[model samples]
Target: MKDFIKVMKALSDPNRVKVIKMLQQREMCVCEMQEALGIAQPTVSKHLKILEDAGLVQSRKEGLWVNYRLSGGGSPYAASLLGNLKHWIETDPEIIALREYIPGLQRELVRKKQASPAETQKKDSSAAQDAATERRETHD
Candidate 1:
């Protein structure tokens, strides 16, 4: 009963609900969530802390960065709560707004993922092309 009340209390906040809905798509860093939700980092962290305390969110640290996602708790009650949240937010207008931010967020994530290979290749190519143009200009 006490756990149930805590879970309910966590879900009662609209910001927390939005954060959960966002997590349904992908794990996110606090910075990305701040951009998507148009909220300050501290506010996002607060919401995340509430969700974490309720067992609705799980987080892991990668070096200095911590990423958060929906927690797949072993408890049946926690699972049911997560399911209900999924169903409720999927149909809500606020959650729909989250969809608008998703594409940009996904693109950013992809860009980050692609950076290691893409960065050097792109910079080298650009430099080479600039050098070629300079050579051509001098020759002309």
Candidate 2:
């Protein structure tokens, strides 16, 4: 019963439902989901966490990204819902639009755009150091 309620609660939000719909298509990182759903990264992550806790999704570590896919099933409720979801919402305009938008979401480009200010600054510093090193080598 608790599992049933948790799954229900997890799916209560439209964004979360859209997430399940997106995962049904392919595995995606949070950045990709954010771009597709037009939501914040942290919000997307929160949605993933809820979905994971409800056994609606699973994740794997791939290099720097954690990719999420629809879970095979943890409980009967989750499995039943996952199965039903495949046949549902396939025709809604928003769902159709989302599916089309997803393919265009380049994870690498999204990640680059999502880089923190500190990370960007560090990258800039690294590039400057590389230029200085090149100049010094040329002078020698």
Candidate 3:
């Protein structure tokens, strides 16, 4: 019953449950989730760790991004709960809003929005420098 308890604990947090609900639609990275949920990246990562520990979610590395999805293999308790979760509390207004928000989430745009001003400045300057170099090569 330890697995059962773990799954239950993972679902106890509203944010964690929301993460699961979003993953039910498609694979997502932390940045997209952070934007959709309006939560800090560290907090979102913490929730993901707990959900992974419970075997309710799995992750894979794609390039620099780690994407998460509902785990197909886990304790029987996890499978049962994940199956039932599809129909649970989905009618609530918040869940409906979240589902609506997922389609518009883009990781690149979300990360840019979250970047510090200095970081954004550095990127902008770097792009201008690269453009200058490209123009010099083209003229030479």
Tens digit of per-residue lDDT, candidate 2, span 1-140: 99999999998999999999999889998889998989888999999999999999999999988999999888999999999999998998989999999988888898888899999999999999999999999999
Best by TM-score: 3
lDDT of each: 0.81, 0.93, 0.94
Clashing pairs in 3: none
Can you tell me which runs of candidate 2 are displaced by over 4 Å? none
The sequence of per-residue lDDT tens digits that candidate 1 reaches over residues 1-140 is: 87787788888888888888898888888878887888877999999998898888999998767889999952556679788777774767778888777767753564465466778689889999999999999999
- Rank all candidate structures by their lDDT, best first, as comma-separated numbers: 3, 2, 1
Off by over 4 Å in 1: 106-140
Highest-scoring model, lDDT: 3
TM-score of each: 0.70, 0.87, 0.90
The residue pairs found clashing in candidate 2 are none
